[model samples]
Target: MPEAYLWDRPDGGVPIAVAASGPSSSALAGEYADGVIAVEPDAKVLELFDEAGGGGKPRFGQVAICWGPDEADCRKRVLDQWRWSPLGWKVNAELPGPDSFAAATQFVREEDLVRTVPCGPDVDKHVEAFNKYVDAGFTHVAFVQVGGESQPDFLDWAERELLPRLRT
Candidate 1:
C-alpha cells in the first residue's frame, strides 16, 4: 500500500466503503461529524494507534479517535454497529477494498497519507462500487490498485464509467 488515501463525499452523509489500517483513518473521521469508531484486525491495533489515535483536532467528534478495545476480538463489534457493516441492510458485499473499519473512516471526509490498493472486483466492480459510494453519500474515492495486471484497466474503467457520471 502507498500509505496515503483519498475519498470524496458527494452527498456528505454516509461513506461508502471502509478500507483498513492506520493510513485510512482520516476517511473514518470524515464519515462522522460527531466521532469515529475504528475496528481493525488484531495485527493492526498498534499501527492504528500510532497513525490515527495520535494528537490532533480529531476528525469526527471531539474525542475524534475511538478504537475498538479488543482489536481482533471485536469482529462482532464492527459487524453490528459500524456503518459499513452489512449486518442489517443489503450492503454490496463487493467492496472497493479490504472493508476495514479504519479504511472506511479514512476515505470519508478528509484525505490522508495512507497506502491503499484496489481490492474487491475487477474494473467493472470498481466502477459499480465507487458509483454506489458516491450515490449513497460518499464523494471521494480513488483507484489504488497495487501491482496487478488489471491496474490500467481499472483506471480506464473509472475514466469511462465513473468519471462521466460524476461530471456535473
Candidate 2:
C-alpha cells in the first residue's frame, strides 16, 4: 500500500507541511510533516505541537489586515472585502462558490469585520495584532491586505512604518 512507505523526493528541497488545527493534527504533523501551518494564534496548540514534535518545526500563520488612510474607510473596506472570513477557514474552504459566500456574508456588519480583522490606519495596532501569532510561535506570517484596491497607501505605510519596527 502507498501508506506502507515514503517516496523519495527528486531533489529533497521541498519542505512539506500540513495545516494543523489541534492536538491530533499536530501529532500527525509531528510524525510526518516538516512543519505546520497553524490556523490560529493559540500558544497551547503550538506547545502541544512542540512537545510532540521533538522540537519546534517551522510554524506559519496569517493575519488579515485592512487598511486605509482613515479608520472609517478601513472599516468599510474590511466589511466589504473580508466579511466572509469571520466564518473561519474551514467554512471558507468548504463554501461552494462566490455566491454562496456572498449570501452567507451579505448581512455581516462592519462591527463584525473589525472584531477579527485588524482594520485601521494605526501601525501600532497592526504590529500588536501580528505579534500574537509571533508570540504563539509562528516562524513566518502572511500579512493579508484586504481592500478592494491595490492600496498603495497601505503598502507604503507598511514599507516605511511597519517593516522598520517589525525588524526590531
Candidate 3:
C-alpha cells in the first residue's frame, strides 16, 4: 500500500540519481540512474556519462566557495575548513579517514585554497567559479560555502548579487 501510495502521488515518482566520481561510476550512473551527481566540474565525467546513454539527464555538481566581507578572512576560512580540496579526488579517496585527511592536508596553504575555491566578496570570482560547472555541462550546481557561520550572509549575497549575474 505504501508503494502504491507513493506511485499515486500528485507529483509523480521521485527520480533516482547516483553520485559518481570516477569513470566507471559515472558510466554506471548513466546506464542505471536518472541523473548523476558529481563532486567537481569535470567535463570528462560528463562526457563519459553522456556516452553511456545519459544524454539529456540532469548533471549535478558541487563546488566549494568561501565568501565574506573581507577577502582575507574568506581565504582564511577556506584554509581552515577546506584545505584538503586541492588534494584532488585521487588523494582524497586514498586517505582513510578524518585524521589521515588532516595529516595529508596539513601542508596545503591559503594560496592553494584560493586557486581551487573562489574566496571573498568579489561577485565576479564566485561567478567565474560557478561558470566552470556550467561549461562542463552541469545542469545544476550546489555551492558548499566553507565558512559555517556565514551561510546566511552567503545566501543573502547569492540572492541579491550572485543569482542575478548567473541568470544572464
Candidate 4:
C-alpha cells in the first residue's frame, strides 16, 4: 500500500538470533509452511520453513522478505547485512501519501513494482493509512513491531483488517 518498510527473518516474534531456539519456533514454522505464503519478520518464518522438513523446498507459496526499520538498521548497523540478498525484492520506502492511494495503486501496478509501507505504534492512525494502501494495490502488509508495547495492537489490526484485505 504505502511505502511501508518491513524486515523479514526466518523466524517470528523473537529476534533472529534467538528465534531459532525459542519456544515459538515450532509453532511459527508450522503455521505458514503448509501453504508457504507470506513471511513477516521475527523468528517464526525460519522455524516454519525448517520444520516443514521440505529439504529446502518450502511447502507454502512464495517467501517474501520484509525490510522495515530493523531491517534497515541491520543493513546499517550490522556488518555485511547485505548478505540478505538473493531474496525477492529489497523493499524500502517512506510513507507515500500526500497522493491518494488511488494514485499510488495506479503507479505501482502500471510500473509493475512493489514496495514496503512504514508503520508505527498508532493502530487507528496506521490502519487508516493501511486501508488506503490496500486500495492502491498493495498485496502484502507487514507490521514491524519494534517495541513490546506496540506489538499486540499492530498485529491485531493487521489480522483483522490488513491481512484480510491482502488475501483478497
Which prediction has the highest lDDT against the true structure?
3
What is the alpha-carbon lDDT for the whole of candidate 3?
Answer: 0.90
Cα RMSD to the true fold for all candidates: 17.5, 6.1, 3.7, 16.3
lDDT of each: 0.35, 0.80, 0.90, 0.36
- Estimate TM-scores for all models: 0.26, 0.80, 0.89, 0.24
Q: After superposition, how far is residue 97 of candidate 4 from its true place, in Å?
A: 37
> What's the lDDT for residue 164 in model 2?
96
Candidate 1 lDDT over 1-168, as tens digits, reads: 799888875675663333333445543533432333232222242234334533232212100111222323223232333334222112323344555544654433211211111133333433444454344322234433333444465466556655676564
lDDT by residue for model 2 (107-152), tens? 8988887777877778888898789999888898878888747468
Tens digits of per-residue lDDT for model 4, 67-140: 23343442332122222222222221232443433343332421121222333333344455445434432244
Taking the tens digit of each residue's C-alpha lDDT, what string does model 3 give over 1-168? 555643365485678888887889889999998999987889999999998889999999998988899999998888888999999887887899999998998899998889889988999998999999999999999989997799999999999999999999
lDDT rank order: 3, 2, 4, 1
lDDT of 1 at 166: 50
**For model 1, how big is the CA root-mean-square deviation?**
17.5
Clashes of 4: 29
lDDT of 1 at 37: 27
Q: Pick the candidate with the highest TM-score.
A: 3
Name the candidate, 1 or 4, with the larger lDDT value.
4
